[model samples]
Structure formats: C-alpha cells, structure tokens
Target: MGQESLQAFQHQVGDVLLRHRSFLDVSSKYQESNGRVNRAITKAVTECGCLRIEAGCQPFEEAIALSEMKNRFDTHLTGHLCDHCLDTVKEELGKNLFYMTALCNLLDIKVEEVIEKESKKLSTLGIFNLR
Candidate 1:
C-alpha cells in the first residue's frame, strides 16, 4: 500500500510538474517547502499557543541497554496542536512531501525503494542504528 501510494504520488507530481521540471527549480522549491514546514511548526508554538517545546539534553546511562534508550528518550514537546494549527501543519507537510516526491521523480529514484532500503538498514543495525 505504501509503495503504491508513493508511485501514485510520483506520477501525479510528474503530470503537474510543468514549471519545475528542471532540477534547479524543483530543488529550490523543495528547500523552500522545508522552511515552510519549520515555519508552520514555529507558528503553532509561538503564535497559536497550541504547542510548546521544552527541548533539553537527553539523559543517558551506560548501564542501560541500547534497546532501552528508545523508552527513555524525551521528545520535550508539550500539548497538542489545536484544530487550526493541526490543519496548517498538515498542509505544510503535504507540500513538503510533494516536493520530496518531485525531487525523487527528477532523479528517477523510487520513494518506496528508498524507504525500504532505510527500513532494512534499521532492522539490520537494530539498536546500533544511531540517528
């Protein structure tokens, strides 16, 4: 299902990608989409007051197994996105994904293939897959 969705999205992007067919245009739009996503999140926190970020250092202990680290990690996010913020964030993220798919289309890369390759790496490396 995921692979099919990615392929469909790629095809859709290719069909409508008239202005940004060139690598330079698509890449620039992709970068801009990334910034827009960040701005959307920032607005949710700063302007909407729907979410808060209390980021800090993550506590780690050598005695704990690497597998346990996942349970101990702190996202540092407080509260949830209200309806308005949620919709805005979702729209921005959709744009980001569209551009990402556009990039993949330009490079002849399959989004699902990349996802599967990363999934395999994570499974193979398990707890050792840092970042």
Candidate 2:
C-alpha cells in the first residue's frame, strides 16, 4: 500500500469510529493495546511454548565493518509462532495499530508522514540509528 492508503485509513478511523473519540481515551486505549501486544508475545513464549527468547548482550566487534554487522546480530528468538499463536499475535497487533492510528487521528497527524520520516531517518543514520 502507498501513503494515500495509510492516510485514508486514518481518515476512515476518525470518521467511522464512535467510541474513544477523546484524545485521553484514545491515548489510554493505545497504551492498553500496546500492553496487549506484549502480553500476546509473552504468552506465546511461556504458555504456548511455541517460542523461546534466549536474549543476552549481543556480541560486538569494533573491527567488523558496518556492512557485515547484520550477520553477527541475533534476534534470540528460537522458534516461529504456530498457527494459533500467529493469529492471536496478529489480532493483537491489529488492535494496537487501530488505537495508534486513532491516536494519530486525534492529534491531526498522518501515519504515513510519520512512517516516511522514520524511514528517512533510518536510511540516513543506518547503524547509528540506535534504538
């Protein structure tokens, strides 16, 4: 999808959505939705055992070139999500996006513009775009 599609989605969210029109409500819901997304992932790891996170400090070498850094970093994720877990995670993510878009609409900001700016920043900063 293009930028217009994202703008259209934001507009549609603002126009058709009835509840949580207030900025406070939308922002709270956005935060809640984000927690739900995190909880969903946690469940996939703990309850379902479909995934495992073996996270630690990433090994880094100053001598390695920036272009070769991609191969050294690890996600630490052990397994892919099963079908049920994938669906649950996707649903939670969708809800998170809905609330995020709602918040953006409340703030009169375009999601596409935000994404574009972030993309540009990442492209320009490359490995220096830490976090």
Candidate 3:
C-alpha cells in the first residue's frame, strides 16, 4: 500500500481498537495473564506493520495499532487456539479470513486478489494449509 493508504488503514485500525477497548480490557482480565496479552499484542502489532521505529523510539500510532490488533485477535481467535487441535485453529483461521475480507472491502481494496496473495504468503510460511 502507498504511504497515504497505509496511514489511513492504521487510523481505521486505531478507531476499531478504541471502539472495542472496554470489551478487550474486561476480556483480557479474565482470559489470560497480562504478560501473555502483552506478548500477543506485540506480535499482532508488529505483524500488522503498526509498529514503527522513529528516532529509536516507538510512537503513539504504534501503541494504538498494537492495542487494536491485540484486542481484535484476542476477541476473535484467542479462545479458538490450541496447541494440539486443528479444528479450533481452523475455525479461528476462518474468522481471520472473514475479517480480512471485510476489511479489504471496507478499504476498497480487491478482496479476492488480496486474499489470494495473502494465502500464498501464509502457505509459504507453513502457518496454515489454506487449501
């Protein structure tokens, strides 16, 4: 994405995070330890490109993006993930797919093309079998 589009996406993600903060906070309090939640948030933010380095320090945008993605993933996928189970993982993956599809639609991106490209990337990473 171009820089302007990327910034808009980040802002929209931030808004989504803000809208769901209360729910996320309450859910996280009961569902997992703070450390795990933090780790998950960090991972999601980094993966989403919400986190960026500026003068060797992270900015407010990164923090907001991290919080948003963390809440989104936790709310949607956390309970579905398990170390030894593929069924739950598959369900969660489906949820993620639906979410990204919706996001692409909202952003006016081509959902099918993006999904095809992202599916290839995920398949290459061996994260999941999209086939």
Candidate 4:
C-alpha cells in the first residue's frame, strides 16, 4: 500500500487498539481473569507478530501459559517473589509497548498520541496510574 493508505490503516487499527485499551493494560487484567488474559495474549501475539506459532505446535493460550510458568519459576529462583512479579509486569508492559510503537512507526503513524489518549482513558477508569 502507499504511505497515505498505510497511515490511514494504522490510524484505524490504532483506534481499535485504544478502544480495547493498550496491550499492556490488557495484560494487567490477567490478575482479574485468566480468560481475558488469554484473549489479550492471543490478540497481542497475532497482531504484533512477535511470537511465532508453529503449524502443529501448542496453541497460543498454551504457549502463553507455558511462558508465564517459566517466568514464575525463574523469578522464584531469585527468591524475591513480589519484586519479581512487579518487574515482570513492567517488562511485559515495556515489551508490548515497544512492539506496538514499532508497528505504528512501520505504518507511518504517531504512536505517542495513541499512547497518551489510551493512558488518559485508562486513568479515568481507575485501572492504570500513569504518574
């Protein structure tokens, strides 16, 4: 597609992402419900094209669960569960944001505006603290 078409497509997709809240916010929702977490992970993996899924391997949900389990085990080995959890969450957030902003850049979109608007929406919902 031409740059103009790609930019428009990015804006449209960015709107949908904002409406669903940022991928990071959705990842946080895992504490509230695993279903939401799985769905969010699936969407992230599919949309961001970060993780490669083999044709006949485990599904996305299984892969996410396995990855989480590995993270938990690794963190537990460090003997600082609470700190590890917080750090892991932050890492996941950063990773998601990085991939998303990269995608926006590839599409010629302004990621900062999308992030600012989404952060405001989440703050108003009392779910995320940007400060």
Top TM-score prediction, candidate number: 1
lDDT, ranked from best to worst: 1, 2, 4, 3
RMSD of 2: 1.3
What is the Å distance of residue 5 in model 3 from its true position? 27
Which ranges of candidate 2 are over 4 A from the true structure? none
Whole-model Cα lDDT per candidate? Answer: 0.91, 0.90, 0.45, 0.49
**Model 3: residues with Cα > 4 Å off, grouped in runs:** 1-84, 115-131
Provide C-alpha RMSD values for all models, in order: 1.2, 1.3, 17.5, 16.7
- Ranked by TM-score from best down, the candidates are 1, 2, 4, 3
- lDDT per residue for candidate 1 within 42-115, as digits (tens), equals 99999988999999999989999888889999888899999999999899998999899889998999988988
Q: Write model 3 residue lDDT over 1-131, tens digit each, in one string.
A: 56566556545544564433454453443244434445544444444433432233222354555425434332222332233344433544544443453455445566446656876887786523322
Q: Tens-digit lDDT track for model 2 on 4-69?
A: 889788888888779668888888888999999999999999999999999999999999988788
Give all TM-scores, in the order shown.
0.94, 0.92, 0.27, 0.30
Measured by lDDT, the strongest candidate is: 1
- What TM-score number comes out for model 3? 0.27
Q: Whose TM-score is higher: candidate 3's or candidate 4's? A: 4
lDDT pick, better of 3 and 4: 4
